[model samples]
Target: MIIEIKVPSPGESITEVEIGSWLVEDGAVVAKDQEIAEVESDKATLTIVASEGGKIEIKAEEGEAVEVGAVVCTIDTSVEAPAAPAEPKEKEEAPEEEKEKPEAKAAEEKKSVPESSEHDKVKVTSVAKEMMKEHDLSLDDVINGLKRLGKKEVEAVVNAPQATAAAIPQKEATRDEERQRMSSLRRKLSARLISVKNETAMLTTFNEIDMSYVMDMRKKYQQKFVDIHGFKVGFMSFFTKAVATAMDFHPMVNAQIDGEEIVMPQFVDVGIAVSTPKGLMVPIVRNAESKSIPAIELEIKELAEKARNKKITVEELQGGTFTITNGGVFGSLLSTPILNPPQSGILGMHNIVERPVAVNGQVVIRPMMYVALSYDHRIIDGKDSVGFLVKLKELLENPERLFTGGKDAGELMLGI
Candidate 1:
């Protein structure tokens, strides 16, 4: 019996998905519930699992776009019949011609000329092909070179040899052969970013926060927190707590414009900006104020993993009251982060380095991180935005106050 397999619905609002990769080869026996392929959806990447144990035949290939419930493969589960003893299969001998293929490829890569296809030319990337065309090199030669030394060697040939006498005929160079299917998530990202650009009077305001206190606190408690909760306590927890405190204090910063009316959210659903192969996704941690530092850390880590694996849901991506993006992980010294739509503000965290500072009129080396809060200028006034960031900085610099809800709110936030 052949069991037909179809693409499963990944999440809400995702009607289609791009087949990203196949984990098992055709005719390979896969166990029931074994992950066989990965699909990229608007919400996240989902693993296509085997429904029944069997040898499979694939109808879909990698990088192909398929719709939900579309038949993608067939699983055969037929009983094997007895047959006569088969002859011993001899191992194939390596052809001498094939053995020299590597040396040929290497020689081709070393060639200063590029290749053009006379037989249905593989339109190489523009720059590489152009350089080759000018030198009147054959596509077979270039491909052979690529096969020998790989693309990096070929790239060096294309990039370094810009000095070819400009004699190549001008070919209308608009055709592209690299047909990568865009994931649903990427399309959504484009649409949302365009909406933000067109619909909102977005303006970015910048400020730097000193992470010395936050860093020290993490160093002080990270190991113990990890040991107790089975996950390391991270700066994100402190930042989220600080953002929640600041939002509670300056409700305006948490507010967004609803055309004729201003919409203010009483609950703090802080969106964490996580970068994935699909791009930047901000998965919100709803009502972050209620979660402890350990809980917050776990939730953020889980959400980020989901985002990477393409297991995130549309609901998880929606309803972000505010966003926090940390560029520090990528070694960004400082950056002005863009606003994620509907939300008025986004926080940008940067890499920390010890800088000279005057503390009590004395110079000392203190570890510091620069922070930025970009806001929609139309709704968030300069004073409120700046003041809100100041509040964030103050809480972060003294994280104990974040647990205590700033200097005046005491430790009521922690329910202690």
Candidate 2:
């Protein structure tokens, strides 16, 4: 029986996809449920697997754009895949005489020509020694093979400056160019970036935070956290927690304009921007406001691993109310991040640097990081944007405030 393998739809509204690559060669035997090819759609890269064990005949070539549900290959189920070869067993030991013959021959050769102390000091690499042994040549035989230098040879070495210069390696320059067709994912990304810049009234607000408190907290409790959770926590989790807590005071930052109506979500779903080989992918952490730091860290790690391995689904990449991108991983000191459309706000984190700043009327150096919030002005005003960042700064600078609903411990205890 012959079974046709068709391309699977990656997501809704996507009609076509480019064949990213063929994992197996054409006409090769494939086992049931084995992945044979990868298809690149505008949203994500998906794999095509075999339904039954059989020989596969590829119909669509790689890099060709095929419509969804089109047949990309067919399987001949009658022809089974060849079984893997069995491992060989160890051989019986050789006769003692056979081994002694080689040892005796080596001893005879060593006695024939005893090397000088100076010659014994010369190191022979394992590879060179193996080659000499294979050729039945000893160290003396190799030394004697060298030709003696004569007067003519000495004169040639002294007089030939140009020849010596030519012997040195030099880099040759070439003007070579190569072009490749853009995949569906890259083309879609290009279109979306251009649309974001043209459609929204985006504005960015910047602020600096003293990271001494967060760093000290991590240093103090990191081991305890890891021992209990089995994974280390990172700054992204702290920033994500801070962003979620600050949303309570500045809910407008999480609101988006839906046509004539402004849709404000009651819950916070923070998207963490992860850079992968295919492109930038944002995987949403659902209900971040209700989760603890350890829980958030583990989820982010799992989602990022899936995204980079091309195993992420379209549903995992959608329905994010706000996004947080850390350019600090790439050593970005500061950058105004572009807004992810439909969502009104995105935060950018930068690398930390030690600089002098006034603290209680005294000059001191502290670890500081610059944070930027880029929001759509159509739905978010300057007052909300600036206040959102201030709230985020307060939460981060006093990380304990995150546990107390973005308020000081004293204020919370005093009922102020």
Candidate 3:
């Protein structure tokens, strides 16, 4: 009996997937539930596992596009397991001695020859040959002198005050090139990016936040906060909380344009854009408005881990009121992030740098971060977008108010 293995559906609307790699070789025996191939969908990478123990017969090749429920391989369950090898009979001492002598002699001969000699041939550049001729130098002279001769080497020898013998090339650095088909995830990302640009009336508004307070707070309470919450209180939670809070005053930035109607949700499902090997995955931090700072940090960490590990589910990836992407992690100074579809806004976070700025009437050095909010102009007015960013800046700059409802929000939230 042969058990046919078919591709499993990775997510909704993802009917096709590219076969990534095969973990087992054809005709190799595999156990039940053993991972055999990696399948890449537009959104995620999934594993194809053997259904039962048997020899595998590959029906699909790597880098090939396979559809959901399509047969990828088969397991020959009827084939018997390979029998264990029989023990060898004791060898005669005379035969063993004879084998040892030949093996030792071969190894000694191998050691006598230098491995470098095997790859001594090198491509001689035209410039180098011309220089050699000009300098009246032989190829062997150049080769024997330097043991390496290129255009640079030839020039160096020629330019030197005294003429030197050319060194023979020993192993040329071969220039190799390769081309591979793009994965489904990369292709999907490109198409989605293009669609977003073409479909939405996108506009970006920029503002800088003073990180002096946030930095001081983190320095003082990062350890305590991590001890209390089992996760460090990073800049993301502050920005996420700020965005959620700012949405309360400027709802238009959070509302998405649905045909002629603008749809607004009562809750804030903030999408935290996570960069994974497959591509960029936005996992929602569901009801971000209602969660505490500690809770938000924990959820973000888990969601990000899941996204990176390809363990995140489709439900987690779908539906968000807005998105926040921190290009700062990759040392980006500033970038105008694109709006995720249906969501009116995406907040871009950049690296923090210490710079001189005016505080009150005097110039003072402060740690600052440039933040950009890209929103759909169709639903979000310029005033609302700018106001939302201003509010976010204020919230992040003075983050104590983030936990409180904005009263004389105590500085204790910042460990002050």
Candidate 4:
């Protein structure tokens, strides 16, 4: 029997995808439901798995767009799995000391550095070559060291007519002639960010939160929770819940503008902005108000793993009423978050630092972090924005209120 593997629909509204790479070589006998190829859609990248055990025959080349229902590959289902190739013996193989220096292509093929430049590719870099090397970026990405080369003006490369047939003569590329195709995700992100900068009435409000209580709570429970769940319990869950609480009380902060009208949502679907190997994405948590600390931690763990593996989908990134970004994860002391448009607000979290503060007329040291909320000042007023952030600070200061509220406080806070 022959099995025709077709490109499945990547997501709702995404009808097509580009074949990023093939995991299995042609004529390799693969196990049933084994991943054979990687497909990158506009929103995410997913594996194309073989449905039946067979000798895999690849039909699609890498970097070509394929639509849903298009045949990607075929498998001769009758072929048995090939025996594993024997490892080369030490006596037959040359030692590493005898090996010659690896070329740029060899280094790229090995993927020792993930951000390696494609053949004859150019990358736009801000810093100088000396500065780049100091930052440990010697040869990872093709950050055209044009400045180091003493070139007064550097030009962007455009694709020339590529050699397609074996009969066609391959042209030796000049140092000045190379093409750099932008990834689909990068293009979309660029357009979205540019639109946000242009269209929205955006403004950022800032405040700092005392980390004393939350830090103490984590120091106490982190070990226990990690032992129980085999994962470290962190401050993100606590902050996520606190944001939810604040959003519940201040609906305008959690909503978006539909032209002349305001679109208000009753539930808090918090979008946590995660930076993946590919790009930045905001995957949302539905009804975050109901999730416990443990639940939030687990979901965060799973989502982060998915993001790293490029397994998150477009649907997962859509419909976020608000967004939360942790610049602290990248060791950021403080930053004003760029508001994710359609949604009115985005919260930026900074690293915790020991700072002096007045407590009851006495100065003392406390672990403090600066938090900034960038919102559309058009709908979310200065008072409500300040009030919402104040509520966030109160929740972080006293986390036990999440478990228990003072009589009417529960209804008021939760909108129950």
Candidate 5:
């Protein structure tokens, strides 16, 4: 019987997809449920698997665009996959007399070659040595096989300087160019970025935060946190928590504009922008405002791993109210991140550096980082954008404030 393998729908409203690559060759035997090919859509890359164990005949070529329910391949279930060969059993020990004869033969072969200094200095690549051994040829036989001595070879030796013979060789120059077709994911990403710039009234506000408190907290409780949570705490979790908490006071930063009215979500679903080989993917962390730091870290790690491995689903990439992107991982000092469409705000994190600043009327050094908040200015005003960043700075500078609803611990305790 022949079974057809069709392309699965990646998500809603996606009609066509490009064949990313074929994991197996044409007419190759595949096992049941084995992944045979990868399909790239505008949102994510998904795999096509075999339904039964058999020989597969590919119908769709790589890089070809096919419909959502098109048959990309067919499997001949009548032809079963080849079985694995059995392992060999242990062999009986050889006689001492037989073992000595092989060693004696090696000694005789060793004595046939001359022991000279010139031969000692000759370098042989591992591949060349292996080939010579397989052919039962000696170094002398290889040397004699090179019957011609060209002018270029003689000039290399005679024109050599007296200093060292290990001077680097000059490479020949050539002009070459190559081009490749962009995948569906990349093309979609380009279009979305351009649309975001043209459609929204985007504005960016910048601020600096003294990272001494967060750094000190991580250094102090990292081990204990890891021991209990099974993963180390990271700076992104702190920033995510801060953003979620700060949104409580300045809700407009998280609100988005509908056709005729502004829509506000009661819960915060923070999107973490992860860079992958295909393109940038934002996996939403649901209800981030209600989760703890450790829980957030573990979920981020799992979601990032899935995205990079091309195992994430389209549902995992949708329904995010806000996004946070860290350019610090790439050593970027500062960047005004572009807004993800339909979402009003995005926070950009930059690298931390030790800089001099005034503290208590004294000049001191502290670890500081620059943060940028880019929001749609149509619904968000300068006061809300600036105040949102100030609230984030307060939460991150005093990380304990995150636990107390973005208020100082003393102030909360004293009811001030």
Candidate 6:
């Protein structure tokens, strides 16, 4: 029986997809549930698997766009698999010819001699001449030395590209240009970015946080935290926890504008913007307000890995109340991150640099990171945006609140 393999829906709004690449060749035998092709949609790339074990017949070529539910290939389950071919048997009567192979191979590998006119004045030794003759080498193969020619020198010259490459001057290659079609995800990203700019009243507010506390905390308790949680404590966890807590005080930043109504969420679901090879994917951490720092760190790490490997699901990419993107990993000093559609706010974290600052009226060098919050002005006012960042700054600058509601760090660290 032949079964048709149709393109599966990648996401809610996705209707068509371009065949990214066929994992199996036409007429190739594939096992059930084996990936046969990757379908690229506007949102994500999905793998199409063989429904049952069979010989596959590709109906759609790679790079061709096919609508959802359209047949991409057919599997012929009725045909039996072909038998493996037998290996060749070794011959037994080749000892004599094998002995002469070394001499023949040496002759083939020997380099060509220079013109006789070039080395006529150079004296050739009898032993060197015989050795060169046996190896099909020449006088040019011998390097000039204070002593007589040697067999080793002749062998080195023969191994050098036979002097053919050295004899000719090669031309330098010119730069060439090649073009490829835009991926559905990239195209969609471009359109959505433009739509976001035109449709929303976006405003950016910036603040600087002293990272000394977090750095010191991580340095002192990182090993202990890892010993208990199996993962190191990171700055993102602190920032995520801070954002979740700050949202309660500034609920407007955690709200989105739907049509004419402003929808405020009861729980904090923070989206982490992960940069993947395919494109940027934002996967949400649901109920981040309730999750522990170690739990948030583990979930973020897993989600980021899945996004990078193209293993993230459509459900994972949906419904984020707010987003947090760290351009710091790529050394971005400062950047105003754009909104991830419908969401009212996004926070951008940048690289930390040591700079001289006034602490208690004294100049001191401290690690500082610039943070920016871009929010929709439609529902969030300028005061709310600035206040939200200020609150985040206070929490991150003194991050002990994350572990204890403002208690001693030693007690909390010991408890963990």
Task: Please report the candidate that would top TM-score against the real structure.
Answer: 5
Which residue pairs overlap in candidate 1's backbone? 42-185, 44-310, 45-310, 114-132, 115-138, 116-138, 116-139, 209-371
Q: Which is superior by lDDT, 2 or 6?
A: 2
Q: Output the lDDT of residue 143, model 4.
A: 44
lDDT of 6 by residue, 120-188 (tens): 766667777677767656666554423775898788766765456667998889898899878788888
What shift in Å separates residue 157 of candidate 6 from its native position after superposition? 30
For all predictions, the C-alpha RMSD in Å is 13.9, 8.0, 11.1, 15.7, 9.5, 9.7
- TM per model? 0.71, 0.79, 0.73, 0.72, 0.79, 0.73
Q: What is the lDDT for 364 in model 5? A: 99
* 3 against 5, candidate with superior lDDT: 5
Tens-place lDDT per residue, model 5, 1-416, is 99999999888878999999999999999999999998999988888889899999999999999999999999999999998889998898888766767777875565444323457656667777777766767787778879898999789778865555567676879798899888898999999999999999999999999999999999999999988888899999999889999999999988998898999999899999999988899999999999999889999999999999888999999889999999999999999999998999999999999999999999999999999999999999999999999999989988989999998889888999
The 10 consecutive residues of candidate 3 with the worst lDDT sum are 110-119
lDDT of 3 by residue, 207-326 (tens): 999998988999999899878777788888888888888888898888987789989888899999998877889999988889988889999999899888777877788799999999
Q: Give the range of the ten consecutive residues with the poorest summed lDDT in model 6.
A: 108-117
What residue runs in model 1 are displaced by over 4 Å at the alpha carbon? 61-63, 79-181, 409-416
Worst 10 residues of 4 by lDDT: 149-158
- Per-residue alpha-carbon lDDT of model 2 for 195-295, expressed as tens digits? 99999999999999999999999999999998999989899999999999999999999999988999999999999999988888899999999999989
